[model samples]
Target: MANARVDRLRMMLAREGLDAVVLSHPHDVRYATGYHSILERWTQMEPFAAAIVFADPARPAILVIPEANLGIVAVLNRDGPHCTFDEIRSFDMLNFCEVSRYVDPDRNGGQLAEDAMAIAGAIRGTCQPDIAAAITAALADHGMAGKRIGFDEHRVSAAVAPKVPHDYRDALDFMMRVRVVKTGEEIERYRAVGRMADRVIAHAGSLLHEGADWNGVQAGICDFMVRNGVIPVDEGAMLFGGSYDGDDFIPDLFRTPGKRALRRGDIVILETQGVLDGFWIDINRTAVIGRPSADYQRLHDILRDAFLMMVDRLRPGVSTNSLPAIGYEHLKAKGVPAPEKLLVVAHGIGLMPLEIPLAYPAAGLAGVKQGFVMEEDMLISLDSLFFGAKLGPCHMENVYAITAGAPEPMYAAPLELIVADHAPADRASEPA
Candidate 1:
C-alpha cells in the first residue's frame, strides 16, 4: 500500500523537480508512512522526528527518529501496510534523556541498557548535531547531497535543517495534491468505520428523550461504539449533541458538548465522530425529541435535496468548482430558497475528516481559480448546513467515495427527517 503511495508521490515530486522529500509533521508522517503513535499529538515537540523519501527507487527511504522511538516504530510497522523504509537512524538528547534508557522507554526503562561509560566522551558523539550528521550521511551516500529537498519548512528543526545541501520546497503542497483520493484499502477502512458510526448514530437517536441531557446522549453513543469494538479505548473519543431549540444551533459545529437538555419539539443535532482502527468518520443527523414541526420537515427535505444535488455531481470527471452553481440551480428547481452563503458544502475525507479537494476560499473555487478536479477513488462528504431565521438550521452530512461508475454512500441511513419520540416511561414535563 505504501509502495503505491510512494510511487504516486514520486511522480508528483518529479514534476516539481524535487529529488527527495522528508516528512516531519505528524499527520503527513502518518499518512505517508503509516507510522502513528499517540505521542504524535504533541503540540510543542514531536521528539524531532522525520521520515525521508528519495525519488531514486534504488535508494530506500529512511526514518530519522530519536533513539527512544526506534523500537516502538519498528513494532508498529511489523504487521501493517506501513512504509518499508530501509534505514532507521537514531539521535540522542544526552542530558535530558539518554539513548540507552530508550531501548524500552516505557517498559523496562534502564533495564534494557547494557553497562555504559561514565565519561562525557562516551555520549559526545550522540547529540542534536548527530541527528543532522546521520541525515547528511544518508544524502551524501545516495548522491543527493546538493539535490532539491522537500520538507515542511515551518516545522523544520535547526538540528535537522542545515544538513540539507539543496533548495527546499514545502512538502505539504505535494502531499495535499495527492491526498484528495483514497486508495482501495483506505476506502474499505472508511466504509467499515462509517458503518460502525452509523449504528452508533441510530442507537443514540433511539436513546434520545425529551429531558435527556446532551451528555447522556453523547455517552450512550460513545459507550455503545466502544463496547461493540468500534473504538478500541476511551482515548477522548467522543460524540456531541446540541439542542437547537428555536434557532439555538451552534453555528460553529465543532464546539464541545455540554449539558444542554433536550426539550419537547426540540431539534437535536447529534454528531457521531468515530475512529475505527485508524480511519475517522464525521456524520451528522438531526432528530426531534417528539413530533417535529412542519418547518422541520420542510428544512429536512430542502437540505436533503441540496445535499444530494451536490453529491450527484461528485463523479470522477466533475470539476469541484461547479458545486455552488449546481446547488443554486437545484434549489431553484425544487422551489426552495437559494442559499445565500455556501460554506464547505463538499470536501474530501480520508485518514482525517477533511482532506484535499475542499471547496471555496482556500482552494479558490468560489473565486478565481477553477477548483480541484475529482479523481477516481476519492472519498468525500457532501454537507448541507443551509439555514435562515425562518427556515431554522438543519445539518445534513453523509460520506461517499468517487468511483469510475458512480459514487456510493458509505452509510445505510435514509436521508429523511428522523422523528425520534421518547418512550412514555422516559417522558417528563416539557421545558420552555
Candidate 2:
C-alpha cells in the first residue's frame, strides 16, 4: 500500500516542479521516512541524516543515516513496519557497530547473525564516507543530479550544494504546508498523545498544594510522563505564578521552574508538552492553590467561555485568522478589562507544537502571506491566556480535530479552573 504521507509529498513536489526534496530536519526526516534515530535528539549543529523524497511516487524514498543506525533500521524492517524508507543508505561516522563480531556464530552463539548480516548487506554498495557524499551519491544514483531540489534547512542545502550540481531551493514553508493536514495514522497518534496529556494534567493538578513548589510539581509531571512512555520536551512542565509587572504577556514564557512554594489563593499556570512517536502533546490548564478571588473567577469564566465559543466555530472553511477576532469580540462583549490582553492563538500541532498555517500572519518567500483555513483531519491547539495583575495568569488550551461538523476535542478533560484546596475542612471551596 502507498503511504499517504509520501503521496502528499509527491503531490507537493510535482506542484512546485521540483525533482526531489532533501529533508535534514529530524521531524521532517521522520515524517517522510518514518525512521527516528536517537542521534536526531541533538540539535542539528551539522547534518546527521537526510531523507530524499522524489516527485515520482513510483520512486521509493531514500533514507541516509550514519552506519551506527543501520542495525536499528534493519531490525525495524525485519521485526515490524516502523521504517518506511524503501532504500537505506548509510555513511561512516563513529565505529559503533562491528558487523564482523556480530556475524561470528561460534563467538556470539549466532543469536544476532541475521540482523548483523542485514546491516552488513545494507552497507555494502549503499554506504558513503560522509553525509555530503552520501546525499550526492544518492542523487546521482537516482538520476537527480542538476535537477531542481528543495532543501528543508539552509545548512543542509549549503552542505550539499558544493558536492551536487543541482538547483537547490529553500523548502521550509513548502514542507510545512504539506504537513499541515494530518493523515489517519497521524490523527490516531494525536489522539493517543492527547489522552496522555489529559492524564499528565490531572496528575499535575493532584500534585498542587499549599506548600508545593514549581520545581517539585514540574519534576512530578516529568516523571509521570516518562513513566507513561512520553518524552517531555521544552521546559517539560512550565508553572507560571501570579506575579508580573507589565501589561504585556509573560516576559519569559519558557522560564525554568523555581522552588517558590505555593501559597493560599496563588494562581498557577500549568503548561506541559511531550512527544509520543514523533507527535507532540501541548496542553495548558490553570489552577488555584486555594479559593479563587472574585476577579480571578470572573476572568477565568470569560476566557473559558470565549475559548469554548471559538472551538464551536471550528469547522471546515473557517479561516484561523478569524478565531482570535471571535475571542476578542466575546471578551469585549463580556465587559472584560483590557480585552486585547487576552491573547488568543490557534495553531496546528503535530511533529511540532506550532506548525504552519498559523492564526497570525506569517510571510514566506516573495512576501506571500501564509494563513490557514480549517480543514478536515487537521489537528489544532487553541490557546487562550489572560494575565491579570490581581488574578495572576489564567490559561486554558485544548487540542481539537477539525471535522466536517463540530470540532472534536481530542481529550475529554473539561475546560475549568482547578481549585486545589489544601484543607479538607474548608467546605466553602468547591471542586473545579
Candidate 3:
C-alpha cells in the first residue's frame, strides 16, 4: 500500500520537479512511509524520525530511527526505499548526512551539481524555531538555497516560516490536488471501515431504550467503538427530546437511566462514530419509541427529503455553499420556520473528524466556497439538520463519494425515519 502511494507521490514529484519532500506530520508520514509509530510511549517527541524518496531510486535513502525502531523500519522498508542508519549524536548530524547525500556536494561535488537543483519540499505540523533552523540549514547545505518551495499556509505554523531557505506558498492546493481523490484501493479500505462503523452504531442503538441517560448511552457508545476497534475523534453526542430550546446543546449534568421512562411518543436521537484504519465515517439517526406524532412525522419527512435532495444534487463542479441554502430555500418554500441560528450543515469526515471544504454558512473560509468545486473521489457528508423548539432537533447525515456521475452514498441504511415499535418482551425492566 505504501509503495503504491509512493509511486503516485514520486510521479507527482517528477511532474513538479521536486528533489524530495521532508514530511513531519504523522498523517502524511504514515501515508508516505507506511511506518507506524515505533516508540513505546505516545509522547509528543518522535524518537523514530525518517525521510524518504530523496532523489531517484538509485539515490533513495530513508533515515532509520534508533536500535529500538530497527524492527519497525524493516517492516516499513519492506518494499526497499533504501534504509540508512542515523547514529545518534549531539547535533543529530546523521539526519543531515543522509539527506545531504542526495542533494549536497559529495567530496564528489562536480557530479552532484546536476542533481543540485532538484526541488525540496518540507512538511511540518507547525514550524517551530528549532525545526525551522534544521530545515533551513539542511537546504542551504544542499545548494537548493533560493528555489521556490511549498508549505500548507493554513496548516503550517507561522513560527516555522523564517527558517526555510526559499519562498514558500500555501501547498494545500498542491497537496489536496494530489491526496483528496480516492484510489480504488483507498475506496475499498474506506468502505470496510465504514461498514465496521455501521455495525457499531447499530449495536449502540440496540442498547438505548426508555430509561437510558445521556452519559450512560454515550459511555455505551464509547465502549461499543472500543470493543469494535473504532476510535472516536470527537466527544459531542447531542441527545435531546423535541425542542428543549437547545438546552441539551450545552454540557450538562450527566444522567443515568432511572425511573424517567421514555414514553411511546418520545423522540430519540442516535449519533454514532465509525473509525477503521484510522479513517472516520459518521452516521446519525432519529427515531420514535412507538408511533411518532403528526408534527414530528411531517418535520422528519421534510428533513429527510431535504437530505435526499442534497444527495441528489451532489456531484463534481457543484459548490458546497449551495447545498444548505437550497435545503433552507426548500424548507422556506414549504413554510417551515427556518431558524437563522441553527447548524444547517458541515463537512467533517476522514483521518480527523473534520478535514476541509466545510458546508456551514458561518464557515466563511475560502476553502468552503462553491467555485472550489467538488471533485471525483472526494468523500464528504451531506447533512440536513433541523432544530424544532417544540419537538427536539432532527438530523440526517450520510457519507458519500463524489464519482463520475453523482455522489454515491456509502452507507446502506434505510433513509426514512426508523421506528422501534416494541422494546424487548421483558418490558417490565429497563435496558441497562
Q: Can you write out model 1's per-residue Cα lDDT over 113-207, one digit (the tens) per residue?
A: 22112112122223344445656666666676567888754445334456555766766767776666666767877888878767776776777
What is the descending TM-score order? 2, 1, 3
Instruction: Assess the local accuracy of residue 409 in candidate 2 as a C-alpha lDDT between 0 and 100.
Output: 91
Q: Ranking by lDDT, best first?
A: 2, 1, 3
Q: Write out the backbone clash pairs for model 1.
A: none
> Model 2, stretches more than 4 Å misplaced?
74-79, 97-113, 119-124, 158-163, 234-236, 239-252, 358-371, 423-432
For candidate 2, lDDT tens digit of each residue in 1-432?
356788888998999999999998888888887887777787658768888899988777888888767666766667666767767777876554335225554564353555645555534246677887788788777877688999987766676666677898878878888898888888987888888888878887888777765666677777877878888874445534333233222323555535356677667777778887788878888888788888778888988999989899788898777777888898799887778777677788899888865322353421112347888988988888775555566788999999898988997777899988865343232122
List the candidates' TM-scores in order.
0.80, 0.87, 0.69
| Best prediction by TM-score | 2
Candidate 2 minimal-lDDT segment of 10 residues? 360-369
What's the CA RMSD for each of the models? 6.2, 4.5, 9.9
Off by over 4 Å in 1: 45-48, 77-83, 93-133, 154-161, 225-260, 341-344, 357-370, 424-432
lDDT of each: 0.63, 0.75, 0.53
